[model samples]
Structures are given as structure tokens and as C-alpha cells.
Target: MTDQPAVPTDDPTVLTDRDLEVLAEQLGREPRGVVGIAARCVCGRPLVVRTAPRLPDGTPFPTTYYLTHPGAVAAASRLEAQGVMREMTERLGEDEELAAAYRRAHEHYLARRAELGQVEEIDGISAGGMPTRVKCIHVLMGHALAAGSGVNPLGDEALALVRDQWRPDRCSC
Candidate 1:
């Protein structure tokens, strides 16, 4: 029996020095440690990353980082919103004709909803319903139209008709 402390099976909560170095390389900056990582998230508020620092018995475990700062979280939210808007604008374009078509289709949907007594309780309509199914077809058509290459409008209309036929009312009739 050798008189030596049992080799700790526990892992470190902080990133290994090598791991930190690699992270720094990927991030293109020097990360001093967890504090540095946390500081990066901090803009106007402290962006603390909560992590599982240890096991049940205080044995060190892998760190799991989470954003805890409101400002950092808000910034992330803004970035996501901007990305979505940019994508929508890029895909849909600012074309007057296309915009008018979408508006007309949307108005039709609204009218259909009102006729079905579904305007107040929007959840009343099922995905299998005529209006909802047609809405989906419109969405697909919009995507196809947005491609802006050699898209066949007749094919889009035909596909929309096929989709409309699959609706519960049409299927039953």
C-alpha cells in the first residue's frame, strides 16, 4: 500500500488552460479565464454564465454556461429580431406588385375568417380547414415566387388548387 492521496477522479469546473487557449483562438481574443468569458457577455449589465461547477458531493464537473445578464440577453434578442426582419425583407422584397398581392391574399383570409365566424376566436379553425390550408398554400407560393428565377405562376396556382382540395370541406364534398 503506497502512502499517496487517491488520484482525484473529479474534473475541473474552469476550462483547461489548453481549452481556453483554443477558445481564444476561435473567438479571436485572449480569454483570461471564466471571468474573461463572463466579461465578454457583459455590455451594460453583467452577463453571468451559470454553470454546473461541481457534482452532488462537491466533485468538480464540466461547466455549463448560461446568460444571466439582462443587457446581454436584450442584445441577443435584438440581434435575433433584426436577423428575422432582414430575412423577411430580403426574401419578400419591396416590390409593389408582390406586396399588393400578399395584402389582397391576407385580406381574403381575413374575410373568410369573418364569414366562418372565426375572426374573434382564431383558434377555432383547424390546420385541416379550408382557410388555414389555403393560407399554407399561399405561404409556399410566396416562397416560390421569392426565388425570382424562372418560376411558373401557373404551376403555383395549380399546386395551390391541389392543396385547397385537400381541405376537410373539399375532401368531404
Candidate 2:
């Protein structure tokens, strides 16, 4: 990944100049390889960005839906600090149905990223420690926000856990 200037996009999630500016502000750097805004706050600020599978600098970016909202990022961090990932990871080992669902979620993530473009380096890999572990609530929450509820069970759970602190329905931007 190089620190190149963000590439402009014409995809369906194509961002306006204002949107790019806000994204840069939220990320504290230039938002790289962003194709579209996957999720937005109630007030219309970008909450999750749909990034290119391959970056402009020829880096394979496995994370397609990246959470950028400061409030949502902080909420996911708070959940992680509360030992939620350990509990979720433990439950994944004990629940067959949940495990299957998580695997499906992983597949869904891969499929979505495939639409952007095929990146051999990240092929078959999805972010958020999907299918086996609960590594980053930020990634899962980003997926949840981008794909909507029910597509990602763990992501949905993470979103639920942080509802009191942050929610898509509420303006936390």
C-alpha cells in the first residue's frame, strides 16, 4: 500500500468532492482506492467506504468495506476492550449453526469484493477474521453496515452491541 493521492471513481458509489474531503477528514489521511460510499450516517456522512480490491499502487486490499466513521470506530473499539471478541470466538467453537452462518458471511464478503475486481493476492480471503475468529469488530461492523443486517451474523451482533453508543439510524457523525 502506497500513500498515493486517492483515485477518483465512477462506480455506483462514486463520491463527490465533498464526500472525499469528509472521508479524508474522518480517516486523518487521503482515502485510497475508494470506489464508493458503502454506508453513510443518518446525516449523510460516509460511515463505511467500498474500497477497490486492488489499490492504485498495485497492492491487494482484502478489506472492501472499511469503517471510517470516528464514532462507529470508537464503538467497535469499546466492544473489543470489553472482551467481546474472546466471547464471540469462544461461542463460534461451540455453535454449529453460528459457525456455518459465519462461513456464509465470509463467502458473501468475498463475492462482494469480487465485484470490484479480482486480486489474486487476496482471493478467497475476507476481512474481520471471518469464519473462524472474531479478530476486529471494526471490520465486521463495516461489513454489517455495508451489506445490511442478516448478511453477517457476527457483524450484526457487533452492530447491536454498539447501538447504544452508535447506530446508523442515529447521527453520530
Candidate 3:
């Protein structure tokens, strides 16, 4: 809704039954509120899912793009354990340019979620602690993949760090 540049969503891609099954297998449960495959690997497996703002159970789900790939999730969890989030949060405090870019990322995320459906309960709240601090690399990486490049600086950085471990070109699927 704001003046931020639009991030390309899954308007061109369609999710198949196989994709759903794979996602469900990865999650170990039925995928909920999933609208479409936001990002995929080179092997064409679903990496990120574009979910509804509110779940079917009437619960507000602010995580618009969710990372579902097992390998990527593990890498992000490893990064979290290594205190990458803490370092990123500290950097955000000292870096004006990074903070401004992160704010735009939050706005872009909100606009994308609004396109799906806005939930009043989770209004203006983007996942993984955007526009402020780094809470979850998995969420940020999901947004970075969904939004493509440059929309989220921190997310981009996190993705770059994990590139050797999980590259989009190299199929972990």
C-alpha cells in the first residue's frame, strides 16, 4: 500500500498435489493456510510457502512466507545457534542504511500479505522481526527468496551466508 517497490509473488506459479505432499512430508503435518509456492529450488521443490494472513481455525498468522525445506531450516537453525541473529541485531543498531533498507523490507512484506488478506490482529507485524531486529533467519530467508533480491538487505545477507550450505541453484530436493 505504501510507495515501496513491488515484490513478485506466485501469480505465475501453481502448486501441485505432489508439491503439497512433499511439503506435508517435510512439515510432518498437514500444511495450513498455504496459498501458493512462493519459492522453489532448482529441482522445483517448494522452499517457501505463501500462507493466508489468517488460518482456517481463525488464528492470525503473520508469517506470510514460510521456509519449509528441511536442509534450509537446519542451516538457519545452525545460524541461530551461532548467534548470527545477535550480531545482526547489534549491527542494525549501528547501521542507518541497513535499518532503512530493513524498514522497506517490512513494508514490502506487509504489502504482499495485504494482497492475500489483512488480519486486524496481526496488522503491520511482519515475521522474523523486520524493520527492527533479526529474530529468525528462516523467516527472513523465506522473505528474501519470495521477494527475490535487494528487497531485504538483512535477509539477503543471511541468504548469502548460507549460500554454500543451501543455494537455490543447487537442488537440495
lDDT of 1 at 94: 48
What C-alpha lDDT do the candidate models reach, one value each? 0.31, 0.86, 0.86
lDDT tens digits by residue: candidate 1, 16-63: 565465444433565322422222211111222222333345444222
Candidate 3 at 156: error in angstroms? 0.8
Q: Regarding lDDT, does 1 or 2 come out ahead?
A: 2
Q: For model 3, give the RMSD to the true fold.
A: 5.7
Q: Could you give candidate 2's per-residue lDDT for residues 99-159 as a string of tens digits?
A: 9999999999999899988988888889988879989999999888888788899999999
TM-scores of all models?
0.24, 0.91, 0.92
Tell me the lDDT of model 1 at 62: 27
Question: For model 1, what is the alpha-carbon lDDT of residue 117?
Answer: 32
Task: Show the colliding residue pairs in model 2.
Answer: none
Span of ten consecutive residues with least summed lDDT in model 3: 1-10
Extract clashing residue pairs from model 3: none
Top candidate when judged by TM-score against the true structure? 3
lDDT of 3: 0.86
Task: Give every collision pair in model 1.
Answer: none
Model 2: lDDT equals: 0.86
